[model samples]
Target: MNGKRGMHYVGWKTLCKTKASGGLNFHSAVSRSGPLKARLSWRFLQNKDSLLYQVISAKYGNNLWDATNRRGSSIVSKILLEGAQ
Candidate 1:
């Protein structure tokens, strides 16, 4: 569809609009929700890694070698497995 004419179709117009209207984009008035979601997801991943590190150290002691890289690798592997599905 052409740039200006893309929104002409009721279906196309609705798809380019907001989630409340069944589109992928968030409401224009509260667009910060998208950025907020990214920030929160980043923070949650960091928190998960931190928590995993703490648990590994507490259970396995300082011998939990290469903890940060290992944790990241595990997450990557898990994602890869899921993606393969």
Candidate 2:
């Protein structure tokens, strides 16, 4: 036999689902980054006194809680703020 595989039996969306949903636990980049962005947002909200928060605040010149519509905020700051919302 040539051992050539035929058409896929399962769709890509089904294959990419979590194992708990009856598929292999594979994470797409967008799916994986969501939780990471949420964690960063949570950290930024909870740890205002931390050095990382202080550094980001110093550079961005906006409080994490009230960072909306800032002029010079970094892209990372904006993304985290959006995720927080």
Candidate 3:
């Protein structure tokens, strides 16, 4: 809809902003996914005794905070660490 012929009345960034900020209140994919990823990371951090967490910890070790060496870390672990940060 950024095309000239289309109804490109507002910019994408503006359209993605919240109505409280004087925009349409639509959420961009990045903004929406960010919170969900963060929530997943938080859950992983808080639910250490959970089965899923235990499995992950067993595979990757329980050192979630020290990700300096990500050589053998799983993709999910990396994503959770980055999202938490």
- Among these predictions, the greatest lDDT belongs to 3
lDDT of each: 0.49, 0.76, 0.79
lDDT of 1 by residue, 1-85 (tens): 4476544445555666777767876345344644655554455346756764455446546443333445554543333233323
The residue pairs that clash in candidate 1, if any, are none
Please give the lDDT score for candidate 3. 0.79
**Cα TM-score per model:** 0.24, 0.53, 0.56
Q: After superposition on all CA atoms, how large is the RMSD of candidate 3?
A: 4.8
True lDDT of residue 41, candidate 3: 89
Which window of 10 residues has the lowest lDDT sum in candidate 2? 60-69
Which portions of model 3 miss their true places by more than 4 Å?
A: 1-26
Give a tens-digit lDDT track for model 2, residues 10-61. Answer: 8767878898898887667777777788888888779889887888878766
Clashes of 3: 0
Ranking the candidates on lDDT from highest down gives 3, 2, 1
lDDT of residue 45 for candidate 3? 83
Which of candidates 1 and 2 is the stronger one according to TM-score?
A: 2
Q: How far does residue 56 in candidate 3 sit from its true spot (Å)?
A: 1.4
